[model samples]
Target: MKNPFRLPRRASLSRPWRWLVPLLLVLLFLAVLIWLPWQARQMEANERQEQLIADTLWVEQTLRFELARSEEALAVLGADLVSKPPTPEQLQARLNQMFKNGHELRRVLWLGADGAVLAHHGLELPPAGLAKVGRETLEMARLTRAGRYTEPYGASAHAPGMVDYYLPLFKRGEYAGSLVASYSLKVLLDETVPWWFAQDNDLALLDRDDHPIAERADGGPGRGIYTHRRALDLPGSSIVLATDSVKGTPRLLPNLLVGSVIVLALGLLLSLMTLWRHISRTLAAEAALRQQMAFRTAMENSLLTGLRARDLEGRVTYVNKAFCQMVGLSAEELVGKKPPMPYWAPEAMKDYEERFAGVLAGTITPQFETVFQRSDGVRVPVLVFEAPLVDSRGRQTGWMSSILDITDRKRA
Candidate 1:
C-alpha cells in the first residue's frame, strides 16, 4: 500500500534545494565581497604609483627647461661680446643683471679663444681655471664651435660643486670666445621645483652612480611605498630626479566592515540551520503552515535588500536586519515606529508624506525612488518595490516593501 505519511515526490525533490541553494549563494556572495575590495585596493595602488611617475617627469622637465633657458640667455651675451666689443666694466654690469634674473645661475664668465678669463661676475675666478678643471666640455665647445655643458665639478671638502654651460662664439667660421654660465645644483632645485610638490615628496638629484647631489624633503623622508625616478637628458651629466611620496598604500577593508560581515554571516547561517532542524522535527504536525512561515522568515533575513512590513493602520509591524543597518540604527529602534521615520531625509519630507499617504489609501506605486538619511547624516539613494502583504488564508493584510540601496548604481 502507498504510505499515507510519505512526502509528495515534488516536495521531496525540493527539500534539499530549500537549504542548499541559499547556502551556495551565501558562499558565492562572500567570495565576491572579499574580492571586490582587494581588486579596488590594487587599482588604487597602481594609480598612485603612476601619478608619482608622471609628476617626477614633470619636475625633471621643468629643471631641464630652466637650464636650457639660461643657456640661451648666455648665447645672446656671447654674441654681444664677440660683435659689439663691450668693455670689461660694462660686461660685468650686464652679467650682474643676468644673475639677478637667472636664479639658477651662480656665476658668469667670458673666456677668450686662448683660454684666458676676460671678465667674470659672482665670486672670484677659481685658481685651477676652466681649461684644466673642465677641459673636455671647453674643448668640445671650441671644436664644435657650438655650445656644451661641463661635467659638474668642485664638490670637495674645501669647495662647493657647480656645473658650467659654454656658449661658443664663432665669427666667420673662426672660434672667437665663449660665454660661460655656472649653476649650483641646490639653487637649481630650490628655484625650479614647486613648493606644493616638494611638500608632498622627497626629491633628490642623483648622479650616474646613484649618489645624492642635492635633496628637498619638505615633509620629511618618504615611506618608500610610492616612488619614481626620471633622468634629465643632459649630455655631460646623467642626473636623475627621484621622488618618494609621503602617501601610503590604501587598505583593502576596514576592521569594522570585516567584523560586521563575519558576525552577520555566522548569525544568518546559524539561524537558517536552527530553523531547518525545527521544521524537520515538526513537519508531521503542521507541515504546510510552519514550513511556509519558516521559509519566508529565513529568506527575508538573508537578503541584502532591506525589507519592511506595515499593518493596514500605517504602523511598522516588522523590519529586517538590512533595513536597520541601512539606516544605521538597531532593529528595536525601527520596529513598531510610526510615520516621520528617523531615516527619512528632511529635505525629501514632502515626497515621503505623499508616499505614506498612498500606502494608507490602499494603493502603492509598484516601484519608485527615494532618499534616506543615515544616523550619521549621510544621504543614501534607494529604489523601493512595494506589494500587498497576504495572510496564510490568502487575504490582504498590509503593505510590504523591498528597499534596495542604489547609491553605487546611481554613482555609476
Candidate 2:
C-alpha cells in the first residue's frame, strides 16, 4: 500500500525501435539477395544478345571476305582465259592456284564455256563433266542483282560441294564464262565456327531464294528462314532463338533452413521468456516445435507437388520433382535455364513475361495465366503469382513466383 500510492514511477521506458532494428536488417538482407541476382541475370542475358549480334555480323563479314576473295580469284582466272582459252596444260597449272585458294582438288574442278574440262584438281572420283554446264549454273546467277554472290546450286562435278559464292564474270561486260566455287556445309559447322562461339548457338545459311540451305542446332529449337509469297524487289531473312521451359532451384533445404532458423530462434526466445512459467508449458512448446519440423519435412519430401523459382528474366534456377514431372523435363534440362520468350504461339506467354518485368520494376504485381509446353510436346496451363523479393528498406531486388498447375482446372 505504501508503494501503491507513491506516485507511479515514470512509465517503464520501452523503445519499439529495438525490435524494429533487427527486423529491418534481416528484411534488407533478404531484399538485397533477391534483387541483385535478378539484376545480374538481366545483365547476363544482355551479354548473350550482344554476343549473338556480334556473331551475326561475323557470319556476314566472313562470308563477304571469302566472297571477295572468290571474286578476285575469278577475275584473275578470267584475265588468264580471256587472253587465251585454257588448254589442258594451262588448266592444270590453274588447278594449282585453285588449291592455293583453299579449294580441295577432288571437291572442285573446272569447266570451260563449251562445257569441256578446262582444268581440274584433286579428284579421286569426279562427277560427270559439267562442260557447257555454264547455263545450268547461270540459271541461279542471273537472279542476283548484286553482280556478285551467286545463288545456291546442286552438285557440280567441277564444284561437287554445295557452295555460296560470287560469279563476277558478268562484271567483264558480258557473261564471260562463269567462275564458280562451292563450300562443304559440314566443314563450316564443324571447323569454321569455333566451339566456344558455337555453344548453345544455332546457325543457318539461307539461299537467295530464302530457303534454308544449311542449318545447325544445339539442342534448342532450330532456326529457320521464311520466304516471301509475292515476288518483290528484294527478299529478307530472320533469325530466331528458342529454348525449353526453365528449371527451378532445389526448394526443400532452402525452405527448411529458412524455416528452421525462424523456428529455432522463436523457440529459444520463448524458452527464455517463460523461464519462470510452468515446466509443463515449456515442454508443450518444445513438443510443438518438433511437430512443426516434422510437418515441414514431410511437405518438402512430398513428390506429388513440384515447385520452381524464376528470376525476373524468366530464367528458372530452382525446380522440384513435381515441377519437373509436370513439365516432362529433367531437372538437368530446366534448372538454371530460361524459356525462350515471345512464346512461339500463345500470346499469353509473352504477356506473362511483360507482366513479370513490370513487377520487377516495381510498377505493379500481376497474376499470370499462361500455357507452357512440356518436353513431351504437351501444353499445360499454369497460374503464376509474381511478387517482388524486397529487403527491410523496401527495395526491390528480384521476384519470387509461386506457380500452380492449372491443367486440371482448365480441363474441368
Highest TM-score model number: 1
Evaluate model 1: give its TM-score: 0.61
**TM of each candidate vs. truth:** 0.61, 0.42
lDDT tens digits, residues 201-270, model 2?
Answer: 5555554545545554544443332111211111111212221112222233345555566566666556
RMSD of 1: 25.4
Q: Cα lDDT of all candidates, in order?
A: 0.80, 0.51
Candidate 1: regions farther than 4 A off: 1-18, 131-133, 155-161, 254-412
| Residue-by-residue lDDT tens digits, candidate 1, 71-164 | 7778788888778988878877878888888777887878888878887788676666664546778787788777777666666544445777
Backbone clashes in model 1, listed as residue pairs: none
**Per-prediction count of colliding residue pairs?**
0, 22
Write down the RMSD of all candidates, one decimal each: 25.4, 36.9
Q: Report the lDDT of model 2 for residue 93.
A: 70
